[model samples]
Target: MSTLSRVSNTMPTSLSCIDLTVTGALDAATVLGIRQESAKAATDGPILVLLDVAAVTTVGASGVVGLLEVLHLLRARGGDLRLFGSSAALEITRLQAHLGQVTRIYGTREEAVDGGLGPGRARHLAPGFRWHRLFPRRRRTLGWS
Candidate 1:
């Protein structure tokens, strides 16, 4: 039995995709392995690989970097990587990493499977939106005290 099981979905979408359920730590090696598997699948044609991480036991910076690498690799080959599932560790990593794969997360399998081509499309800000307002600027002043 494979640690990551295939999740077959029979839905019509613009993307040709494969759904895999992953368990345990989502480390770099695992992500790289997924990239290799995705490469095999891409032999048939371009595909969007979706990983279900609900059962992921743990996550760290390496995992985040791996995800970003895999994502870029797939996309470069006319494919993509999407992730869905509920795991506190994944959420924490996403927020803390603040790099890639954050917007790739979907709340539910349905949302992920049925989501549109654009990841985090709705999350994009409008033109001229002040980021400082949302993030708050750090204050600094010259003082001798």
Candidate 2:
């Protein structure tokens, strides 16, 4: 006689892509990696930096702040960083909503890779992929600061 045992587990997929992983902590090093990879992609044109934050057990304020900086840097350089499989989208959204135009959030890696930010359009490694701002800038006391 034999008895059957049921098992349940969660594991990340071993998918090969232009992807990066961050866990436990996100800091200057993470930003550096993003910069290096983005610079390389700038040369190639239309670089997609997919960060898998699904396993991020604890994302501190500083870490989230660093992530914002990295995202801004990529956008400034004509590249982009998209959050893939982010289980903590709520936290990220809250932290970045105030910053205005932070990282472009996506539900899946496929959506991010497909560049599905706009309506019924697919952007890839092609020309004319300019980063469009979702909101207009507001004039501040420093005169559009």
Candidate 3:
């Protein structure tokens, strides 16, 4: 028997913090649940998402694939996804290595959020790409202070 737990909390910056606890097998059903929860949490367009997988005991290949898909969807919408905790987990480390620079892993939730895990963060952007070009109307439309 396996267990999957998901809890989501919204941050001050509208970043959704999802804490996932996976014990035993992680299947496609669990992944779907996670995706649905994330979608519910992000109702106002693209937004930064922080995943806390510290309590995950194991990750299956399908789970990894699902996570990658989620990451891609978020990034394509001008948003970003960051993973925190589980640094010592072999599955997480392997996934991080496989994903290379595409994935950002943090040691703590605060570090992940405070480290500029959102849009308009100069550090997160690629070289030669300006924030205005990516989000010209975000500040005006979103009233981002």
Number of the top lDDT candidate: 1
- Angstrom error of the Cα, residue 13, model 3: value is 2.7
Candidate 3 C-alpha error for residue 105, in Å: 1.6
lDDT per residue for candidate 2 within 1-145, as digits (tens), equals: 1111111213222221257655544445555565666566567555556776565555456656777776777667666777756656435544444532344456576676655645676544323223544365765696564
Candidate 1 Cα misplacement greater than 4 A, ranges: 100-102, 116-145
- lDDT score, candidate 1, position 13: 57
Candidate 3, clashing residue pairs? none
After best superposition, candidate 3 residue 140: deviation in angstroms?
47
Q: All models: lDDT?
A: 0.73, 0.54, 0.62
Candidate closer to the true structure by lDDT (higher is better), 1 or 3: 1
Error of 1 at 54 (Å): 0.7
Q: After superposition on all CA atoms, what RMSD does each candidate show versus the true structure?
A: 6.4, 11.8, 11.1
Instruction: Report model 2's TM-score to 2 decimal places.
Output: 0.54
Question: Model 3, 3-101: lDDT tens per residue?
Answer: 666656545555445555555555576677767766665666676677666666666678778877877877777666777666345345454547544
TM-score of each: 0.72, 0.54, 0.62
Q: What is the lDDT for 35 in model 1?
A: 72
Error of 3 at 123 (Å): 7.7
